[model samples]
Target: MTRALLSAALLLLLLPGAPAQVSSQTSFTIVVSNSVTNAGNKTFSTFVSFRGILLGGMRRLQDKDSGFTFKYTEDDNYGPFLESVNGLAGCPNHRTYWELKVKKPDNKVILPDVGIGCYIPSAGDVVILNFNKY
Candidate 1:
């Protein structure tokens, strides 16, 4: 091969765009439950872009899963506050609200300090929407 051709090939190999990798979406599950009682329990399968936020996956679930539905309000201080799931709204008067939890592939559960808008889910993660008091 010509010297110029070889140099061009090496440059192509060094270029970031020359070896484009497809970013596949990640699959995970969301489990909705009533922590105060056994009123509602359901699971939904959904996906999000690699590095996407949890709220994006929840929106995708609502679009694709008929059994899953949720509502949120923008909190100037907290971003997105989960208000309800499956037609059940949290009432401040009753001290009931939705809590965000996550179960990793290793079966360890974590309570994220941030709401859905800020939380990002990993592959095989099980996000729990727990309806609880306080």
Candidate 2:
């Protein structure tokens, strides 16, 4: 298991009196399209890292969970980013990284996942990463 190996690596480092180092998080060039359904109405442009972070863990949006935000959240030059895992069997409904909704002065962005709000992204709508693919 990847986790097991990581644990072992950490243990090995500790055993040798070496400092445990967190792996540098991965990077993404996430692009949100208008899905054609929105059809030229939504914004579809490439936004680089504007100080972002990935999120995951027990901080999942699940009722069955231990009510924890067990996810990995990262920050970079762009916006916050989070990787999500569904709460199915071993998968906890948690985000693996942080995906931020880039701030806007007067814009509305709708996340299909929760359908919670009609957000307005003025600074080129940074996606509030709720999408997951495992």
> Which is the leading candidate under TM-score?
1
Query: Model 2, residue 52: what's the lDDT?
Result: 26
Model 1 agreement with the true structure over 1-134: per-residue lDDT tens digits: 69999999999889787544658898999999998887767988898887789999999889888788999999888798899999989998999999899999999999988889988788999999999998
* Candidate 1 global lDDT: 0.90
Question: Candidate 2 residues 1-134, lDDT tens each?
Answer: 99999999998778747555655432322232222123222222232223322222112223333422223334454333333333211224542222233323244544433211222222344444333323
**Candidate 1 pairs with clashing backbones:** none
Q: Quick one: best lDDT, which candidate?
A: 1
Using all chains and alpha carbons, the TM-scores for the candidates as numbered come to 0.81, 0.20
What C-alpha lDDT values do all the predictions have? 0.90, 0.33
| Model 2 misplaced stretches (Cα beyond 4 Å) | 1-68, 85-109, 112-134
Instruction: Score candidate 2 by lDDT.
Output: 0.33
Rate residue 12 of model 2 by lDDT.
79
